[model samples]
Target: MMYDCNLKIYQTLNVQSEFNIGLLLLYIIEGSSNISINGKTNMYKSNDMIVINDLDHYRILSSKKSVIACLFLSRVELDKFFRFNKKYYINKDKLDLSVLKFYMNKLIVNYVNDQSENEKQNKILEYINQLVMTLHLYRKLDGTIISNNIDVYSGINYMYEHYKEKLYIGKVATQCLLSVRRFSNKLEEVTGMRFNELLRNIRLSYSAFDLMYTKKLISQIANDNGFTNESGFITHFRDKYHITPAKFRKQLENDHYYPFHNKNTTLLRSFEHINDQIKYLTDRDVDYVSIDINMKNKIRSKISTPNLLIYIRDIETLTNNFQQSKLLSMRREIGLFGLLFSHQLFYELYQSNFENNKLVHQMFSFSLEHQFDISFEVKLGKNQNIEEFTLIFKRLLNYLTDCTYFYGQRSFQFYIDASYYQFNRISKIIQDNLKESKVILVLNKQNNYLAKRMSHKVNDNKQIACKVHHEIDSDKDITSILKNNPSLNILYQPNIPNRIESLISIFKWSIAFNQNISMIIDDTWLDSMIPSQSTHLMIKELQLNKESHYQLFELILTLKRLRGDIVYFNGLILMTHYLNEYQIIIFPNMKIFNRLHQRININGFKLGEIEYRHHDILIKNNQLIINSDGDTHQNMAEVSFKREIGKLIVQFYTSPYAIKHIYIKQKIN
Candidate 1:
């Protein structure tokens, strides 16, 4: 029979039925029905769409005069479109039911009109495609159903029931009446994971559910879940979940946790929308050339002029000459102080034939004319050939040196790894060629090459910025790193950029110590590959709440609005007071999740009259209090002036990972 032949419309019905297999789509066009799929029952009314996947045991109880449209596709047919290797259940509630209803109506109309089989099948296929795209299918990690082989089915069921116990594949094979090798092959083929991996995943699923819904300690959860040790559990969890169990639990505690997907769904889906923003930011045609200089200037005028270097690690895109408009748009959207390229990429471009050289020259010329500082980071592997490396490095340096003559002695920054054998030689080259620019040596905590050792080698007239890697997990680590290295100017390389606590702590420390920090805008910041990650500032392209449109935009604006030096920073909170204005950022401490209900009090501010604006902060009776209840996304107040009287003490309670920005100013008398 034709594909469309499987769809049938019932005008009147009084029946209870079960469907053993195939994919089924039912739309209630006229009346309501009580439907139960796989033990759960719900009343589906008119305009409602329901999707039943393969092997679903569904029963339908309908009233007389009820109109229902049913479209069924067999397993053979569904396999042609989707991979049945893994079981998929549609997230019916998460989808836009209206869109599915519209397509369902179209299919029903086409079938009722006695349309040609070709046209009918095409419509059916169209509806199926929409269903697939709109309904983000939830894939279960608890092994695929093996209906054909009773032994395999029994084995899988046994595995599920005893997943918490220490399982050996040989014993499982014996229970299934099969050889060990046969069972292993069958399990891998059906579940896409090996014996140990599959068992661990099954345990993880239960542990994650408990983590989200229960208040059990990490060690207790790990022990109960059959993990050999808490550390092993954490390692496996991070590998699969992309974060520590504590942080994962902490993120769920946040009021902003949307629970947008299934419990089995990874936390990564919450921020998966960020991929769209990244795609938009990076979209470009390779053949497109740069716009005229006047056009570039006009584009800059249309938006807030951004001034921050964008770290681009993908060098091939640059060499391929991906549209300069995309780069310009990035600069327009997020201020690009300049473009930093990997030294290896520059070397490759330098060594390429004359045509590649022209491309490089064109890129540098455009960047220089646009007031973008071009910089490079040279990372040397211990096994690198020094002779070849230096040769290419010098050539790239020569090109930058030449650009300076044209761009009027522009300053250029070079970040050389401490591992480089000729660190001093490279520093000397930068010092002699670019007097105003800086050469920062990147060092880890264990590096024996202290600032003092390097300080004596360089001239006193030359300034060397000390940059150390910030890796340890506590405030004490930051204190020790700074106290021991007084000249440390930059927190060179920070890991786990997505963790809001880590980012906030780094920013707080930088502001407190009057030091500058940097971010490497690479995949770690842009990519959301796992479920256990927290939300960061993501740009929404469409019209959202215009008042709080682009969060990253607001963050950059806040950074620009700081009046003077940051006066107070205690990791969780930061304050900057200068002239007539004060800027303070308050956020909950993730370590002490219990203290979230408590209030924070700050005093000692002299003011004749107060003009204050705040975002997600409650200020009442000279205390900064939490909103008790607020929207998921934090809000931002437009810059305004107002009058207030009484003590300046501020007390506030905050939600997990919710960073609030408040601005207070004294009215000029």
Candidate 2:
């Protein structure tokens, strides 16, 4: 059998190939070859890395078809590897060979494995390293491969593994066996930034996840991720986002809305709110109605009539006393009931009833053909977080009554057992499970006192989520909310759509032409999130059934893949698994400017977002005019996920891209 100077030509390169004394230095340089380094005899594209030393025979074949780069270096070059491996061992498996993932992700040949020239350069290095290792000299050198550089390929691995915890500079220091000073210098050289800067970037990245995905509080976020106080958190958030935490949160609230079929307020409650239950599902052309809170429903009329009424039931009151009875009857009739005892001032009571009347009018009026308007404020003192309510709510109510002259108003219908916290808890249980969670609904029955008491504290926005605090809802109740709101479109894929084929197809094709795909993983932010995987797994046995669980597992795995993408957002996504496959371009979980989705080219050269010229990146108002300068399209996209407050983390897969666009708008003239 004949072999080329390059590690080339092997006819029997099957699953059981073994390495000879000096054959580890072989690299297939040109053409194509069937070289089985492992049990898989997969095709070797141009620049694929083959690292298998455990095979039975290192057969050499003269392939008119394949070219090889074999570096059977003279004994001296083999000596250099000994010196290079002094600080870190030059084992074929752990460091250079098995770190296939590291190389695949790197820009060199891993993610960019399509470049045969790069593959050639890497092959040359492999040969040289093998020579150095064979003579046992590369293992002896203390600081040879650029004295200051630590094996960064492994540092990233550490960050991926430990990013969720409070990682100290010292801990990373111990991993490298370098002094703090040495570590800092070397890290800067390898990572292109200082230690603190890298850490800040990590924090900022984590903040994005929190902003887009979790229900955690701002202050809690600070504490959970190792910050000492709220000020530190606000400062960090403001610095990165150019806005305060509250402001960021408000913006996020505008992005996601849950259609409320909420039983407490909707007046039309019976059914559960599902994606397919939107009103506009039947008619997409109609405008959505929102009852404006401004107009007051006056009881003024020349003719006598029963003007208003209220009803409160299912109560365990302090007493079935006459005073309680009197208050309940008046509030039930006059509409100002919640104001009298609510806070001593009754201002919020007036405000709430005013909005309630507006909603009532909208629901009853059919001639209202325009868009609706609405706003609401729910008091927190008596409902949720009772301790805080007791202190803060009591004080606020006193302030309302004392200075604001809200005292002595016989407006409220109060009950001893009424409280907001229990309302939310029971209501949420009922609303979420609909009919199937019967056991949960039954247990909730015992907590009716808390539910009724807390019910008034909730405000359903009517547009987004109809938050029924009901533990179980009938279809009719859910449908009523949809029937009332006739504008928004609704659709649902009730069962989890099988996304496996889509993912596998992407992987296979990503390797073929070497698609450019990138992934960025952010573990720290994922850790701080409350609803976690480990918890869900534990709860699955207690709460969920088999089919429901399979979908959950699929979702978790999908998230893990997404996390992997988030970690290395700025670089190449290396696919080093299964026989040194190939390279591709990719951008994982980057916050691209929502408007610029299609306007820019999202591959190659520089990584970032872009802005288009003359046309809105997204069809804001339609007229999309093509720019002639073509070159004016700016490069890159904006951050993918921006705000964390009030944002719901739903699952969806979007194609990641980078491109150029123009920034033509310059404020005012």
Candidate 3:
């Protein structure tokens, strides 16, 4: 209940994928990750404090000999904890050098050495007592005292704010109207470090984080963080850590796998993907849904209380296919859906049951559409407090969703048919946050009333969008449109052979210069429209990772859908990557137009409307040109680079993994 100064094992083994509430993990060391409180399976490394909240699954990725000080309990349980012990929780200010480390190590030792129930319970209680004290102190210090006396805390906040920049102590001292020596002495007395040394420490800490958290070049990190030179930063970093930055990172990775660091890493996140990391948490008879889309095989597998991936194109029966996985578990509730499981289609039982529960696998395939439902409850193996965990789980999901999509991080995209309604709602929210920021809207065709309404919100204080489409009559039309609807501007967009040209047209009219666009997908295919190359750029904009295949796929497919293609008729690129398990054909550009034809009219979808006839596409002189085979060249990387007929040509590039050796060598040393 009350966060004791100790650690407790909530669950000893792996568990189900469900969310939790009021769970926070404190990091003992520096870690890697851009944690958004919204999604599952985000990467996290050592020493990152994470707050777990709501979600469809739990967050339990890899846990090393990681000693984590977790605060978990219902509000009622926490009240009881506080009632029993008051001094256990600590304030951040009171968390000084020896005591924090001492308690941390104690929790680690206790959890490892003692398997006895009584010992575990005793230590858990002790840990909780100490933690409550720390939390209470943190609140009193952070919430009440700081707000009341802003001036006293302002200096500390200011230091933290600009610490990442190339901090000039001389300038800072001047601002405080003190002599160099006086400022130096005062700062050291206040924060316990010499000014320059403090600056160095801050820079080094940032550098260390950049090394672990980002894949940026060393030079880039040094330059961005205001280090004079990479070598200078390297020297200081080595002096501080007794190892090179590279070596330190190598050590971090090793420490995670082997016992090296004195601290442990805990990822505080929503409980959605927790099951993947944990091996023992089981499912309650509660109902839940598992959505699995496998592109390689173009299959959507289903399992009730099932956590397995299914690729629908498999020759084996769903039951036979998952037969092996069943042996790994003694208890499981499994079911199948789709055309692959047609034999069991007529069996109209509400739910099927197996005596000795083992593996769970389900499949279904419908020509037009395939739908199924599953419900299950993920339980924290340590205890059975469903209501409490659910609250945390839900909160965590909110954070994750923000991290996954809404953030300025290259997390979303702009599309031909992004909703004006969604855009307007998002605009209101953004306007509240950035009053002076500019907004842009690019419509494919619906550029009349909706664009006019959204444009009115834009002004000198907050610039509006430059609307564009192919229907305007001459330069006057573009000018007239913007004048009449001062809230918006108009640009020309022609349905032509050149997509790049069209995009260039849109970019040219953007008043924000580099204002990032958030493209909401078509109403019918929202999830399907979330993936694309444009989405990749959005991820870049948001500075988020492109590691999530599902996110990437979703983004790209959404782009395809916007392009009006048959999205799920066949397998997608990812489905192809997953291989013969799914069927994937059709170019993205073609897919869009065809889908539009299919949906908008009865006699649409005729041939000769697409760029790629086959799968191989061509890229020459930075322009996309079609080849005879549709996209036959899609899989072929530029084999070589050369000049042919005075044109800079792609004589060679690379096939997948072909240049991996060169890439790795360059990446390594």
Candidate 1, residues 100-141, lDDT tens digits: the string is 554565555555444575676676666555454434334333
Q: Between the candidate structures 2 and 3, which one is better when assessed by lDDT?
A: 3
Q: What is the Cα-based TM-score of model 2?
A: 0.20
1-669, model 2: which lDDT tens digit per residue? 001121222322222223221224434434555654323455664444554331113333333444333333211122232333223323343233212322221212221123454465554455334334333422324333333344543453355346557777788777867777877876666555677766665565455446444778888777765566879878887776667767765664332211111222111112123113223222221111111111122112111111111111112121234323433343333223121122222334343443344532332121112111111123333334645444443433333233223223211112222233443443343234322211111112233333223233323311122222221221344344334433211211112222222333333222332222211111111112112335544464333322233232222232222211111111212211111111112322122111122111121112122221311122111122233334323323232321223221111121222211122111232
Question: lDDT order of candidates, best first?
Answer: 1, 3, 2
lDDT, residue 564, model 1 = 59
RMSD of each: 21.5, 29.4, 30.0
User: Residue 544 of model 1: what lDDT?
Assistant: 27
- Candidate 2 displacement at residue 646 in angstroms: 62
Better structure of 1 and 2 per TM-score:
1
Reference-based lDDT, residue 143, model 3: 33
lDDT of 3 by residue, 517-633 (tens): 221111112112133224544654233222222333222222232211111321112111111121122222211010110110112111221121112222122233333345444
Local lDDT at 107 for model 1 = 57
Q: What's model 1's lDDT at 519?
A: 46
lDDT of 1 at 38: 72
lDDT of 3: 0.35
